[model samples]
Every structure is written in structure tokens, then in C-alpha cells.
Target: MKNKSGSFIEWLIPFCFILCAGWLIWHLPAFTLDWVPPDQSQADNLRGLHHRNDVTPGMSGPFGGEADWVDYLALLGLPIFLYIGIRTVRRAPMEFESWRPADRVSVFIGRVTMMMIILLTSVMLYEVLLRYVFEAPTLWANELSLWLAGFVFLCAGLYAMQQRSHIRIFLLYDICPRWMQRLFDTISTVLIVLFAFFLVYGGYGEALDKLWRWETFGTAFDPPIPATLKPTVLIIVSLVAIQAVVNLISDWNAEPVIHTAADDIDQDELEKIRAAVGAEGVGDLDVTRGSIQGNQTERN
Candidate 1:
């Protein structure tokens, strides 16, 4: 086993990230950007929802409290996402031979560009038709579009990590031998955990302060600003923190071994990593060989 430095400090990073994220969520107010529909006809309709202290006495959206409930559930996705991200990053590096130079960039761009284009087109189409043709607009469509945008932004970060396409300097790592490279990887991971933990613990108070205010969209659109998204942000941050921990575990003991079972297995990739990193007798499978077999099968 490669000896990891600063054992206590290594564990501390993830803890800190969790604590800081909690503080941020609990103390911070929901983020709200100004939103005004282009058309004026239906814009007035939303005014009451925007900042109406004149809320009809005992009135709420359809399925009373249903919207809020949905918001709460949506918030849960953040943590779940972060958890997935950390797991993906910490998972064993692909066997070098298994990787293509374009793979990382391709995945990153494909997800972002496709989603952005589709959303932009849809939003523009809605606006043009609603304003010029129908002369009417709906609140649900606008809000739903914004929500989709938010989700797309969230997934982008996680996907970037997965591709290992994030910026890094190779001045030292480029020339380092295998063992030395491993040492640096271990150290960097430890710092990541430590920093993440500290951020969470220190920032939790700030998040909570905002939550207590019952902040809303502050616009006619009633976006559910503070009350909705703050909680979700906290959840997302915590999940990302957990992934960091899983990453440490996966990398600290991985090896370069190959698994030859025909059946695809969920953990098969991770197992291969552990063997290779551990420098055991097994090495990475020849993906080239697999590709050849696949081609042959297609011809047959």
C-alpha cells in the first residue's frame, strides 16, 4: 500500500466541505435573477405573484403547497448529483490504452452543446409564437424552461470532472516516473478533501441566515427563489463532497489489473483500476482486441 501523507488531514477535507456547504445553504438566501416577460399583456397578470404583499388571503397555487413540495424534491437532486460526481472522478483512471484523446472533450462538449442548443431553440420558439401569434403567454412554460437551464448547468460541472478535462499543469507531472506521479495524485486528493470540508463547516451559517427569511422570487413570476433553491444547493454541495471521499478510497488502492470476463459488470472498471495501480500481475485488457472481436461479430 502506498503510504498517504497527513492521514488525519486527508480525512478532514471532506468533512470540511460538508460543513461549509451546510452553512452556505442554511445561511445564504436563494439566488434570484431578474425575470420579465417580453410581452406586456400577460406581464401584468404575474404582477400579483411577483411581490404582492396583497396575496389573496389564504390563497396558494394549485394543489396548495404542491409547488413548494416539488421544489423541495428537486433540491434533493443536488446532493445526489454531487455524490455521483465524486464517485466518477475518484473511480480508477481509464487504462491509458483504453482512452482516446478526444473522448474527454467529446463527452463534455456533447452534453453541454446539445442541451444548450435545444433549450435556446425551444425558449425562442415559445417567445416568438406567444408574443406575435397567440398574443398570450403562460407562466408554467417560462418557469419550466428556467428550471431546465439550472439542471443543465449543474450537470455540466459533474461531467467536466468525469472527462478529466479540467485544467491542470503538467510541468512536474509530465516528467515524473510512475511512482512519483502516484505520490502527487495522492497528495492532491488529500488537499481536495481537506479544503472541501473546511468550506462546508465554515459556510453553513451563511446559508442558514438566508433560509430563515422566506425569500421568494421577488417578481411577478413567483420563481420560489430563496425558499426553493438554497436547500438544493446545499444538497448538491454535500454530494460532491462525498464523491471526493469515494475518489480517495478508489485511488489510494487501485492497480493496473485486467478483467477478462465476457459479461459486463458494474464494478469491473474499478476492479481493473485497483489491480493496475497496485501493480499486480494483471494489467489492463487490450481494448483494441475487444474492438476487433466486436468488428468480427458484426461481419458474421
Candidate 2:
């Protein structure tokens, strides 16, 4: 039953993404064009120059002015995609060091970050090809890549926190008593939460204003980077704080762990390499297979 459910979700997510992507592509002309002026034939709006308010009546339909079946489908697919992203990551092996509900959320965001990175790369490559090979560079590609890159950076930070891979000096932590370790964890979590709080509190007004005005980048493409990213920064930071608290709670009773220089090594990755190269080949390469074996034996 578990495998069957996983198979279903695996198929469903891609199908839903394709549906959404197709919907976006179908509306690409509308999205890229300047909003049609009130008296103008919608034909003249293709310069893609205007802001949100200048969108044509036809284009405005998706934003609640009028209803379309495809628009509804796209809207419904998004939350389903988000749900599946969370669910799928929960069932997968941990690529990082931790596991929790918050970790699941962060991993899902990491998956999204991966997709955005791919999209950004594709856009840049497309622009390069167009500019160098076809001599017809696009105005929108650069702005769109920038927009995707920003989200990728934000999402990566959240994922890094969940993985416990963010920078830390554990020299003192390794020597501390378990109680002291818990105390240190609590202090760090509190500090993170407080920083997120002050950031949101101090910037809420300006973020809200930018969003309300639907601010856009001043480029010819004029993507809504400022409007969306300002609020997103606050949101992602808040999520990071929540994830920190979750990490603290999850690790509250975990056994005390000793840290050392060897802790920096990724045993899983080394094992993968050892498997690929075989025991004899690994020995020939002097790949520290013996040390890894010793560590595993000691842990057991």
C-alpha cells in the first residue's frame, strides 16, 4: 500500500506540474505584454511594457475579474503541488542530517529551490544561445532568471537550517554536558526567533506597501521582484525561525554527541563512492575505506 501510494504521488505531481506549466505557457503572451490601455485594441499591448493595472480585460480574467476553467485548474493545482512536495519529501531518505515535520517542509522548499535553479539555468542558456547564435536576445530572460535566483537563495537557507548544515563552532558544544547543550540550543533558537520577529515587525509596513502597490522591477520586462520578494523574505525568515524551534524540540532528548574533525566527513557519500569503485579499487585509490569501516564498526 505504501509503495502504491508513493507511485501514485510520483505520477500525479509531474502531471499536475505539466498542467500548470502548460497553462502558464498558454498565457505567456498576456503575461509578457504591456497591459492594454482602455481605448486601445488589445493587439498593441505586445510590447510587454506596462504594469499590472494595464493588463487587458482578457488577461485580467485570471486575476478574479472573470472566471475561466483553466485558471481555476491552475489555482487548484498549486496547493496540491505544495501538498505533494511536503508528502514526498517525508517518505524519501534524508539527504541531510535531520528529520522532523519542519524538516519535511524545508526539504520541500529545497526541492522547489532545485526546480528554480534548473529554470534559471535554462533561461540563461536560452538567452546565451539567442544572443550568440541567433543574434536575438530576449528582454525577459535576464529578469526572470534574477527573479528565480532570489527565491532559490532564500529557500536554500531554510533547507540548510533544517539540515543543521549552517555554520557552527562546535568545539565548546562537544565538551559541554547534555544539560548545557540543551541550554545552548535553546538560546540559539530563541535568538533566531527574535531576529525573525524584529525583521518582520520592522519591515512589515514597507513590504506591505510594496505588495499592495504591486511594485515591479524597472526593466523593460518589469517583473514584480521587489513586491513579491520583500514579503517573501519576511515569510521565509519566519519559517526558518519556526524550523529552528522545531529542531530544538526534536533534539531536546537526543543523546549527547561528540564532535571532531572527522565529523566534517560525509560517511554516506564515501560509502557510495566505495560501492561504485569496489573494495579493491577503493583500497588502490587510498580512499580511507578502512577509516569509514572502523567508524561504522565503532558506531555499531
Candidate 3:
């Protein structure tokens, strides 16, 4: 019963997003961020509700300068939509011999980013169809797609780390003894933590400022790109840091794996090829002369 309730809520969020997006597109004219005229202060209008100040007069207090209703729906929906996705998703480009809690979280976040790819493409497709088929194009589509793509790119680092797909030159570390390898790994993780901490430390202040001040990108749609994205940077960097720590812990007990040229090859893949061609010994005729002749003279 508990699991069922959680699943329902998870699916409900995306449904709400679809409804909100559809409603906004339908009632585009009724909504207007341009509450102020061009002759007046345009900056305040650009800041809109995202400002922490009384930019919109009576529209002040705690939720005063935040993004619009639809923007809120979009912001809230995307993460949950992705959260649902990673819950039952599979591995991506990288494979891991063992999975840790952090790896699981990163894998889930990675899948969420993958979901954003489809969503971003879909917005573009919607724009194309609307412009060509109906002779109308949306101004919001491009910005929406850009916003989604940003999250996809940022979250990808965490996904890569979780998958063990991030680039690493094993030249020196590979040849080290088991103890030395562990030491190297520890050193590497410490560096990552330090860097990650630095980012979070720097970005945290600005991110809070953005959220508190309700900053925005000041576009026509005026999505809270800065307001949302700033916090996301802190969150993403923190996740990366956590994953680094996770990697250090997970690999702590492992033996040093000495990589070779052969380690790169997928051995199971080679056997599949041999089996398909019925490959035997070196002189084995997996391909008959007749088959080759038939292949060469197919058009003849």
C-alpha cells in the first residue's frame, strides 16, 4: 500500500506538468509577464515574481518574487519525472562490477538526464510541427528545450562517475602496488572532494541570493534559469563530491586491477562473432568460396 501510494504520486507529478504545459500553451495570450509597459521600468517586469522585493506591488512577501505558476510546475515536475525514471532504469554507456548506494543514486540521476533528452527533442519537434504544419511557432519552445538540456548536461557528470565511465589515465596508477593504488585512489578522491567543496562553497552563497532575491534570466518567457540553475549547480557538485567519497569507500577493499590492451576488448562479443560465422581452427572455412562468389556477383 505504501509503495503503491509513492508510485501514484510519482506518476501524478508528470501528469500535472503535462496539464500545466498544455494549459499555458492554450492560454498563452491570457497570461502576461509584461505587467509593466515598455515606457516604464522593464527591468522590474523582467525580474517579475522572481524578485524577493515588492516588484509587483501587492504581490509581495515570501512567495512574492518567485517564478510564475507554470514555471513552478515545470521546475517541480522535471526532477520527480526523472526520479521516477531512474527507479527502474538500466545501465548506460558504462558498466560497474559492483553497485553502491551513491552509484545507485547517480545511475538514477543519469537516467533522469536521459529522459530529459527525449523531452527536449519533443519540445523541438512540437515547435517544428506547429511552425510548418500550422504556420505558427512558439517562443517558449526554444527556451524550454534549452533549460531542460542544461540539466541533462550538468547531471551527466554524476551519471558518468557512477557508471565508472569518467576518463582516467591509468599509466602510473595501474602499475602501482596494491597499497600504493589505494593511496593513489585516496589522494584522487581527496582532490575531488576539495574541488567539489570549493564549488559548493562559492556557489552556495550566490544560489541562496538568487533564491532569496528571486533572480531570473530576464527573457520574454522569463524562466527562472538563474534561480533554479544556481541551486542545481550546488546540488550537482555536491552529488559529484558524494559520489567521489562513495568511489573511495567502494574501492577501498578491492585489489588493484592492472589493465591491458586485452582488458579493453569485450571477450563475450568476440565469441558471438565466431559463433555466428561458425569459426573453427585457423584454416577453417567459415566462409565458402561459393558464398563469396555469390556475394560478389549478386547484381550479375
Residue 18 error, candidate 3, Å: 11
> Taking the tens digit of each residue's C-alpha lDDT, what string does model 2 give over 51-118?
23333334445564233445556757877786776677543443655666677678767766766677
Choose 1 or 2, whichever is better by TM-score.
2
Estimate candidate 2's RMSD in Å.
8.0
What's the C-alpha lDDT at position 6 in model 3?
A: 30
Query: RMSD in angstroms, all models?
Result: 14.9, 8.0, 8.2
lDDT of 3 by residue, 192-251 (tens): 899988998777898876754446667786656676678888889889889888888888
List ranges where model 3 is wrong by over 4 Å: 1-94, 260-276, 280-300
lDDT of 3: 0.63
Worst 10 residues of 2 by lDDT: 46-55
Candidates sorted by TM-score, descending order?
2, 3, 1
Clashes of 1: 55
lDDT of 2 at 156: 91
**What Cα-based lDDT does every candidate model obtain?**
0.46, 0.71, 0.63
